[model samples]
Target: MSAPANYPIESVENAARVLLMLRDRRDLRVADVAVELGIARSSAHRMLTTLQSQGLLQQKPTRVYAAGPQLVQIGVAVIGATDLRAVARPTLERLRRHLGETVHLIILDGSTIVFLDGVEGTFAIRAAERTGDRAPAHPSAAGKVLLASLTREQLRERYPSSRLRGGTTAAKKSRRMLEDELEIVRSQGHAVNLGESEIGLHALAVPVRDSAGNARAAISVSGPSVRLTEDKLTEHVPVLLQAADQLGASLS
Candidate 1:
């Protein structure tokens, strides 16, 4: 006997796949998606049209379909306050208490670094710019760690082709100059924000890995930039790493 018909789960799943492909590829024509998914050209057209009507996708002047601006807004809304906030809150507080400095939990969701959680340190002078404020992913310590985890192709796909926007010199980000930073983070096992994201701020970030060894987020300590130098980093970096390891171990 055949099972009863239900929601078009297969179609819905395919739609999700198509949405992700559009997100990664950006500016894809119908044929490009059809070839990628191995679906008939007609089926691809229908899917694209359906998604476009729902504001999940858009067809541009070049007739290329991409993730709609509305889709990005929806994604930002859902992803802004994620479950990581709940999972990492106490960890962040404990980490701040141990270091006596501010701790921030940052996650790389798409091209943005989402501030998921944080514990403020009681240093009369501390790194308390804002909570839940997002910065573009390049100069931020958390962004560098996340970039180190991606393959070259994946990196290119996520960022615009021409520009690299790491930030400013005090923050060290410009469009198209991030390769060196990623290399350093990969080799050093962590990333540093040397007043790069902000003039007087210093941050060191360690990767927070899940059971799959994928960096789900980063744990970082941000303090006065004046005191955070290469030599001092030697002492403080380990504390950040240990905190990350404990978080990772709990995930296991």
Candidate 2:
């Protein structure tokens, strides 16, 4: 095999080196970073300040720096996404085969639902490709299932006001209405979207909970409303629930 070509950019390489140094040491100082990188103190200070601003580094009360909350979040997200995709693909494929509808694995990121992976159905017409796309939480079945997992205080913090955007006429536009819907979702152990996130799309979702019963993700099946009627959706609920349970157990 040919050796990989090296394209080293000086500033980026130095910043990466600094980050690696901080990985083994906490409460780092700019002078320490400078000494380790063999760079000027002023340059080290500038790099540290930039990283701190972006939440990669945090300055302590004692004037030392450590990894910030954003960095921790990024790390967790990376690990979780990798593991989830690997573990959930078989279940997602099985659901698609059983239901003949698009299957999706999703997780909530802040106020939005992110599609981590998906399997297209056998039908010619199917739900839109959702992998790597983010949609507002209020209008998606997967979003509601995931949102219902949060505590009341967390819900309050996430949606403080009643005014919210609607993706379609079926979508909840007010926080009060959304909260009421989420209460039903929690009680029913699932959520439904009938032309809410997109016109003519119907979706049903159930949470994949960990050992502690906290929802870590959601698995959903979606298709055109013409074929995915309320009766069909209700009929498919047990299948989705079973797959979700199996996947959750494996994850736990």
Say which candidate scores most in lDDT.
2
Which tens-of-lDDT digit does each residue in 1-252 have in candidate 2? 234339877788877777677544546798999998898999999999888899888887888877665665565477467787778999999998888899999999878787777899989988854565557888999999999988878887878876878579879998889889999999999999999999999999999987778888999999999999989999999999999999889875
Q: How many backbone clashes does candidate 2 have?
A: 0
Per-residue C-alpha lDDT of model 1 across residues 1-252, encoded as one tens digit per residue: 235357657787778778777434546678887897789999989999999898888777788876664675565468753455667778888877877888888888666686666778877878873344467677788888987899888887777555555456665444345876788789999988777777777788889987789887898888886776656766887878877887877674
TM-score of 1: 0.65
The 10-residue segment with the lowest total lDDT in model 2 = 67-76
Give the alpha-carbon lDDT of every model.
0.75, 0.84
Best by TM-score: 2
Model 1 misplaced regions, further than 4 Å: 1-77, 171-176
Query: Total clashes, candidate 1?
Result: 10
Give candidate 2's TM-score: 0.70
42: Cα error in model 2, Å: 39
